[model samples]
Target: MAAAARLAVAGHRVAVYERSRTHGGGVGRLAREGFAFDTGPGLLHLPAVHRDLFVKTGKRPLEQCVEMTQVDPAVRHVFADGTDVALPNASRAGVVAALDAAAGPGAGERWSDLVNRGREVWDATRRPLLEEPLREDGVERLRRDPYPGAARRGLFRRAAPRTLEAVAARELKDPRLVALLESHALAYGLDPRVAPASATVLPYMEQTFGSWYVRGGLRALAYALYERCLERRVEFFFGAEAVGVVEKDGRAAGLRLADGDTAGADLVVAGVSPGRLAALAPGATGPSAVPVPPGRVSVLLALSGARPEGTVHRTVVHGDRLAELDAVFGTGAPGTGSYRPTVTVLRPDDPTTRPDDAHEAVTLTATVAPHGRVDWADDGVAAEFAERMVRAAAAAVPGLPERVLWREVRTPAHTEAETGAEGGGVPAPVLAGAGGAYLRPANTTRMPGLYLVGGFSHPGGGLAHAGMSGALVAGLVVEGADFRGSQ
Candidate 1:
């Protein structure tokens, strides 16, 4: 969709070649019934990045398109011992107190310092790394400099620990806090032992900048983007799937579609995964795309007209179900763990995502291994996952099962098949064993006139980042822009 919009905005008459029948697949679009949801991504932060996408197309005033509220205490957590922890964005002191209650004394201060340091690195790298494109040696560059136009790779270094366990052991003291912190690593398809510490800053963005609950839903945001694209006169392809790259000699030319049709152009901007592009490439080595690891998977639930009793506008992360957590996220030392499971709830007045008091909804998500790890084609697996997730959600809001009018579920494989995201990734970089750089594909593939976008490309995933990265990659293609210096 970014490719279609940007290329069209760039005067190239663009079209999206998607495997799924919907736009924003998983995260943005829903089907089969009158119900709808931005089911995948529940939290939205970094409005600036989204603004960047709009500004380039004179859509900067996207603010007027939707009613929005910046939610405080972006997350409300229920711990194993039956304690509730609700902290707003940047409520470091409050978070610390919560930590003390759940873990031990002095934990609050300890967390405050760690979070603060992470913020420092975030401030230094957010713009360059998260916002801009990077050099081909992007990961290595971050590993080396990271502060001035470089991010602190200290959170993840070649020799440093890469899993959540290592991060917990090195920075945090308590086992429970470690679990809490490690739970976050699932965003990057990592185990606590192998996950990068820099990821710690992600939560701060919500805590500090706060998350937005747009008056309608994420699908509304997608609709807004689609409208902007239409307003810009960008070409639209509802269910077109690009079958392969159309190459002529050394310079790339256009694309071939699954429908046996060809679209000719001077440039090709692949909004799909780099590996997917590789799969379609006619060649093996040069000008070809690289591979990306599968991203984490989640079990999402949308209970028809059900809201947790004590739900707040902020995200609710139920953390007490340790047995389920192990089944989902795993207890391995980072290398052995499987997936990290999570439960997120929405508030009643979440005008953006909820319906007009017509029906209530609650979603449960768990990060699991990508693709082959789980078989969603089997109704048995999907049903089992749904039952388990519903049980978890019921803990927050009783009688939920009785009120559930419909149940919607998506696994990593479902997400991957729908969006073509690497490893079913929603834009998080994948790394654990070796070089982090190797895990990420370059903005420009081996194919000339071909580029990458979405979360899998450069800056990572999340809607805001994906929107902005689209613009950045478009500029690189249009102006021959060098991306090595991007964060």
Candidate 2:
């Protein structure tokens, strides 16, 4: 939608063909009996991406489209050892103080120093990895990790940590602190043990920009973008599934729809996954070495009681780190019975989410094996894992079992049915290390007039990165091949 709106404003006739009736692909909402819950991401990080989109494409800003506010005390962490700490939103001093109070002396300083190093990583790759189109030399340039190593004490020099896990153990030291650092990677389906140390930019981005929430839910933001696209005269055709890309004279000329109809276009921009793109346009080059990422399991809880005052919007209930990582990433047993998996509990204090002050809505999410790895469609399998997730969530929400009026469980099977991603895999953001294993395919493909957009392409996943992907595609389309990025 962002790309469509920008193209329309730039004097292009834009038409969006959507397989589903809705606009937002994954940013969906679940509402039952007057209670609502966000089925995708609970909070927005780095909202500036959307703000920039609104500013460039339309007259109204993002604030006018959706009521957005920073979530103070951004996230509360319930560590494995029962130690709890609430980190204030976007405040370095406040986070340092809170960590010191919760994890003993020097703990906060160590974390602060790590984030300071993360800032360096952020600066080094912000342009090449994000704002700009993926350059031809992108892979080679980003293969070298930019995270500076911790200082050596003696004369002998030590090599920098190559992975996030090594960085946490070497710098943070504390088990709770280690969990805190690794959780950021886990949230995006990245295993800390193998994820590049440059992944520290995840926490740095969240802590620096602060977490945000839109009024009603993130679905509102999607609706706003859809509306913005409509205002730009961008036409939408729902229920139109593109089965293949029509090639004419060695260039993409149109799309072959499922209903035996074709929509010819001067330029074609596909927002589907790499696998789907390959199916659409045969012989198209895909990412060289991107792994199939894990999927998310969400449990939506509708409670009978009102949201308690002073309750944090987001809470991370840390579980057994080894067990959680092994179950999700390692070649271990399928079930989560051996250890409690880490779960994130979300309780938004918005009246729109409930019938009235007498009711509350909560969402629980955890990263897990994708559909192929685990049979998410089996009722028994999904229910058992959901039960464990709820049990893990009990550590954060008081009287959670008793407060539930009803619950709904959604697994990767549901995601596969909703979106056509293979095995319901969720893509991770593009990172600058691990020999460019995490980089996504470039926006421009080998076929002329054919472009790629959305989470599966350049810049990769996350609300912010996906939005940036659209911008990059738009720039490439509007300015031709020489376009670099926004100034």
Candidate 3:
């Protein structure tokens, strides 16, 4: 929708062919009996991305489109040892003080120091890896780790951490602190054991930019973007599934629809997974070689009690790191052993989420193996996992199991059914280093006039990265091959 709005404003006749009857592919909402819940991401990490889209595409700004507010005490962490700490939103000093109060004196400083180094990673890659299109030499350039402060081994020598887990162990030193660092990677479906040290930017981005929530849920932002697209004269063709990219004289000329109809076009932008893209444009290579990341298991609870005042909006109930990583990456058994998997509990204070003050809506999410790796369709399997999530969330929400009026469980199978992502795998954000294993496919494909957008393309997944993907595609389309990116 961001690309559509931009292209429309650029005097191009843009038509979006959607398989579903909705605009947002993965961003969806579920409302039942006057209780509403956002089925996808509950918070917006980087609002500047959407703000930039609105500024470029329309006269009305993002603030005028949706009600967005920064979440204070950004996230409360309930560690495995029962230690709780609430990190303030975008306040380094406040976070330091809070962590000191919760853990000890040096805990805050160690965390702050790591994040400070993460700023170096962010500064080095923010433009090349994000704003600009992935250049041909991008992979080689980004393969080297940019994180500063490697521990000194011998005289005039340093041992640089290669992975996020290594960075946490070498720097943070505390078990709870390690969980805090690794949880950020787990939330994005990345295994900290293997994820690049540059992945530290994940938590850095969140802490620096602060967490935000849109009133009525993040689905509201999707609606706002859809409306922006419509206002820009971008036409929408719902239920028109594009099965193939029509090639004429070695260039993308149109799309072959599912209904045996063809829609002619001068250019084609496919926002789909690499697996699906291979089927659409045969013989064309995708952008990256990274394996499909794991998906999420969400349990939406419609509770009978009201949201208590002063309750934190988001909480992270940390679980056994080794068990979770092994289960999610398929290194071990599918079921979480005696240890509980990490679960995120969200209880928004918005009145629109409930019928009245007497009731509250809560959501629990945990990263798990994709559909191909696990049978999420089995009612018993999904039920068991949901039960575990509820149990883990009890640390954050008091009497969680008892308060539930009813619960709805969504797994990778549901994601595959809804979004058509191969195996219902959620894409992780593009990161530097680790042999370019974390890089996503370039926006421009080998096929001429055929471009890729959304989570599967350059900049990878997440709300902000996907939006940036749209912007990059738009720049490539409007400014042509030589386009460097936004200034």
Candidate 4:
């Protein structure tokens, strides 16, 4: 939608081909019994990215379309040791103080210092890795490992901290602190044990930009973008999945629809998984073909009681230390072990989400093994996992199980059906470290006039990154290959 809106605003004729009946592929909304739930991402970060898009495309800014509010005490963390800390949004001092109060005296200082180092990482990579078209040499520069601190030396030579787990273990000595750092990556379907140290940028970005929510739900942002696209005169084709990219004179000509029809165009912008894109065109592939990561499992709750006042919008209940991480990321499916998954409980304060003041709409999400890893189709298995997640989330919401009027489970199968991802897996955004281990498929593809956008493309996943990808593709389309990027 962002790409379409930008292209239309740039005086280019644009049309969007959507396989589903609606827009916002993964970012969707579900309404049941007067209870509304954001089926995808619950919160928005880096609102400036979308704000910039709106400002560039139309006279009305994003604020006029969707109401956005910063989520204070951005997230509440409940550790295994019963220590709870509410980290304030975009306040370094408040976060340090909260850490000091919850973890220990020096804990805050350590966290502050780590964030300071992360600031260095952010500065070094923000432009080339994010704000511009990725260059080969620029990617190589990121692969050199931009982590600021030196690795602890053993009896032999010094070894650089290669992974997120190594960085946490070496720097944040406190078990709780390590868990906190690891959780940041876990939420993105990244295995902290193998994820590059540059993944530190994840938490740094969130802490700096702050978390935000729309008035009704995060899905509102998607709707706002779709509306912006329509306002720009960008045509949309619902239930029209592009089967192949039609080529004329060796350059991309248009799209071959599933219904034996073609929509001719000068250029084609595909926002799809790398695997799906590969199937669309012969000899056309992306820069990187990384394995698809695990998808999300959300348990939507329509409770009988009212939302308590002064409750933070989001709470994370940490679970069994290393075993849980290994279970979720190590194998395709969570194995039978003492694996208690970390659960993120979301209770948006918006009245639109609930039928009335007396009702509450709650959502519980956990990054689970994707479809192949776990049999999401099995009722017994999904039910057991849902029960486990609800039990773990009880730490954040009191009487969680009993309060439910009704619960709905959305698994990877639903994700596949909606988004057409192979295993309903969600891809992690690119990180700058470990020989381009975190790199995603570049926006510009080998196929002429073909471009990629959204999570599967360069700059990687997340709502902000998706919006940025759209901008990059639009710039490439409008300003030609020489265009650097958005200002």
Error of 3 at 242 (Å): 1.2
Candidates' C-alpha lDDT? 0.59, 0.90, 0.91, 0.88
- For each candidate, give its TM-score against the true structure: 0.83, 0.98, 0.98, 0.96
lDDT for each residue of candidate 1 in 1-487, tens digit (9 for 90 to 100): 6656666777776665556676665556454344455566766677766665566565456687655667766666655455566665556677787778766788777666656755765776665565566664556646532211112456643343444455557667665566566555544444444345566665556567777876667776777777777777776676788878788775567778888999887777776665676677744224533433434434433455644445666444544334434444435232213222355555535533445455664556655545554455567766675676566655566677787766677766666677766556554642212345423555676677777777666666667667766767776876686543322
Q: Candidate 2 clashing pairs?
A: none
lDDT of 3 by residue, 1-487 (tens): 8889888999999999998878899999999998999989999988999999999998999999999999997999999999999999999999989999999999999899899888989999999888999986877899887877655656663566899999999999999999999999999999999899999998899999999999999999999999999999899999888899999999999999999999999999999988889889976664446576899999999999889889999999998878778889989986545559899999999999999999999999999999877888888989998999999999999998899999999999999888889778999889999888888888898889999899888899999998999999999999998899875
Steric collisions counted per model: 46, 0, 1, 2
Of the two candidates 1 and 4, the one with more favorable lDDT, higher being better, is: 4
lDDT of each residue in 252-311, candidate 4, tens digit only: 999999999999999899999877888787667634457768888899999988888999
The 10-residue segment with the lowest total lDDT in model 2: 283-292
Alpha-carbon deviation at 164 in model 2, angstroms:
0.4
Candidate 2, overall lDDT? 0.90
